[model samples]
Target: MGDWLRLTYFNGSLWRRFLIDYLFGIVVNNICAVVVAFVILPGDPFFHCWVFSMCIGSLVMWMADGCRILIWQGGRPSLPGLLGIFVVTIPVGYFGGSYLAAKLLALPVEAVLNRQIEHASPLLIMILIVCVFFAWFNWSQSELSELRAKAETEKAHMAAVERQAMQAQLQLLQAQIEPHMLFNTLANLQGLIALDAPRAQYMLDKLIHYLRASLSSSRAETTTLAHEFELMHAYLELMSVRMGARLTYSLTLPPELERFAIPPMLLQPLVENAIKHGLESKIEGGRVEVVAKRDDKRLKISVADDGLGLETGNGVHYPNHGTGLGVANVRERLRALHGDAASLTLEPNTPQGAIATLTLPYEP
Candidate 1:
C-alpha cells in the first residue's frame, strides 16, 4: 500500500502532491467560472454564478484527474481505452458536480438541467476541447518516459559487452605471450644442460615455480602489482641461475602501492626484452632494476638495465626485431584497457642500456 501510494504521488509526498492538485483545481475552476459568467449564465448574479461554477468545475476537474491517474497506473493506455475512460468519467463528474452545485445554490435540479440542455452545443464543444488536450498531454508524457528507459537499458548492455570483449582480448594476448617465454626458457635450459648440469637443474626448479604461479595468474583478467612483481622475481631468479654472477636484478614496490591492479603478465615482457637486448649482449652482463611507484592518481613502473644501451644498435631490440612483437603486444593491451590514459615508452637509461617505462591509471 505504501509503495503504491509512493508511486501514485509525485516525489513520494502525498500531501504535497494533493496540495498541488488542489491548486490546479482552483485555476481550472476560475477559468470555468469566467466561461459560465460570460456565456452560459449571463443573466444570473455574477458573484453567485461564479461561486456555483467554481464548485462544479473544481469537483469535475479533480475527479477527472484522479481517473486519469488510475488509468495510467496500469501502464500506457490504448487510444480506445483512453477515449472510453474520458467518456465515462467526464460526464459522471459533470453531472455529479452540477447536481451538488444546484442543491447548494437553492435552485431546482430541473432548472439547472434545463439551462445546461439549452447551452448543450457550446458546452459539448468546450468539453471535447478539454478532453482532447488532456489526452494528448498524457500520451506524449508516456512516450517520452518509455524512450528514456529504453536508452538507459541499451547503454548498460553495451557497457557489459565491451567489458567481455576486453577480457577475451586480454586472454588471447596472454596466450601468445606465455608460449613465447616458455620456448625461450626451454632453449636456454637445453644449452645450459650441456655446459653446467647443476645450474640447469636449479634453473629447471625455478622455471617450474614460475610457471605454476604465472599460469594461474594468467587465467585471471587482472592481478595486483605485488603478484606480478613476484612472478617477475621468479623469472629473474631463473635467469640468474643461467647467467651465474654475470646477471643481477632488483625489484622494488611500495607497500601502499602493492594493491593497485594491473593486467596479469603485463610487466614480464619488459624484463625479458631488457635481458634479451640489453644484458645478454654485454660480455660481462649487467644489472636490471624493476621499480614501481605511485605518481599522483597514476602508477609508474620501469624496467632499467645497465648494459650495452641502444648505442649498440642491437637489431634484437623491440620494434626492430620482427617489429618488436612482444613489446607491441604489451602496448596494444594497454591501449585497449585504458585508451589514451596509459602508455609504454622505451628510452636510453642514464649511463647506458635501455629503460622501458609504463604509466597507467591506478585503479584500486
Candidate 2:
C-alpha cells in the first residue's frame, strides 16, 4: 500500500503518474468551465448542454494528458515530441468531444460543432494556451534537473581528485619520515653493536619485524585499528629495547573497534612525537599510554606521556628546533579524509605531560 502511494505521488511507476495527470486535467477542465461561464460565455452560463459538453471535454483532455505523460515517460520529452503529440491529439479530442456532446443532446454533429466553433472558441483557445504553458514549464524543469545532476557529478569528481592529491602528499611525507627514522636507528645500532652485541642483536630483530610490518602496511591505503595498533606495539617495543627501563608504555584497544579503518601510519607519528619531545627530555624518562575507545559517534585515539609539560610560551616544544612536520602531516591527512569531521588536538595531560588526541568519525 505504501509502495502504491509512492508510485502515485513520488517519481515511481509511469502509469500511476499518468493517472495523477489525468485527474489534474479534469480539475483544470472544470476550472476552465467556470471561467468560460463567468467571463467568455456569460449568456450561456455553462448549464445543461454546456455542462455535458464540458464533461465530454474533460474526458478528452484527460486522455490527451495521459498520452502526453506516456510519451514523456518513454524518455523523448523534447519540445518537438511534445508539439507533435499536442498537434495530433488536441484537434481530435476537441472535435470528438463536440460530436459526443451533440449526440447526447439530440442535435446534428455538424450543427453542434459549428456552434462550438462560433461560441466556444475562447474555451478552446484557453485550453491550447494552458497546454503550451504546461509544455514550457516541463521543459524548463527538465533543464534545471539536468543542470543540477551535472553539477553534482562535477562536485564528486573534484572531491575524488582532491582526495587523491592528499593521499599522494601523505605518502610523500611518510617516505621522508621513514628514511630519517631508519638512519637514526642504524646510527644507534652501529654504536650499540660495539658496546653490547646481545642488546644490538635484539634491537636488530625488532627492527626487522617492524620494517616488515611497516612495509606491508605502506602498500595499502588504509589499515584496521588492530593492525595500526600492532604496528605501534612493534615500534614501542623497539623503542623499549633502546631506552630499557627509562621508557615504559601501555596499549589499550577495545575488541569491538578492532575493525575500524584508519589511514596507515596515522598513530605512529603521534607516538614518536611523544617519545621525542616528552619522554626523551625527562631525566627519568616517562610512561606513555596509547588508548583507543569509542566516544559517541567518534573514535578517539590518545597518545599521552608523563614527561615535562609544554613550556609556558611555546606549546609542546620539540627538541630538534620544533618543526612539527609529523603533527602537521597527520592534521592535513585527517582534513582530507573527513573534511571538518575529524580533529587532532594537543593538550597538557594531568600533573606533568602532553597528550595528543585524535578524533574521527566511527563506522560500526
Tell me the TM-score of each prediction against the true structure: 0.77, 0.74
lDDT tens per residue, model 2, 11-113: 6544554565556666666776777777886776476435644755565556655554554442337667777767765677777777876677677888778
Off by more than 4 A, model 1: 1-74, 95-125, 313-323
> Model 1, 220-267: lDDT tens per residue?
988888899999999999899888898999999999988888899999
Off by over 4 Å in 2: 1-27, 39-79, 95-123, 193-198, 219-221, 281-284, 296-298, 308-323, 338-341, 349-351, 361-364
> Residue 86 in model 2: shift from native, Å?
2.0
lDDT of 1: 0.79
Q: Judge candidate 1 at residue 29 and give its lDDT.
A: 62
Top candidate by lDDT: 1
Quote model 2's TM-score.
0.74
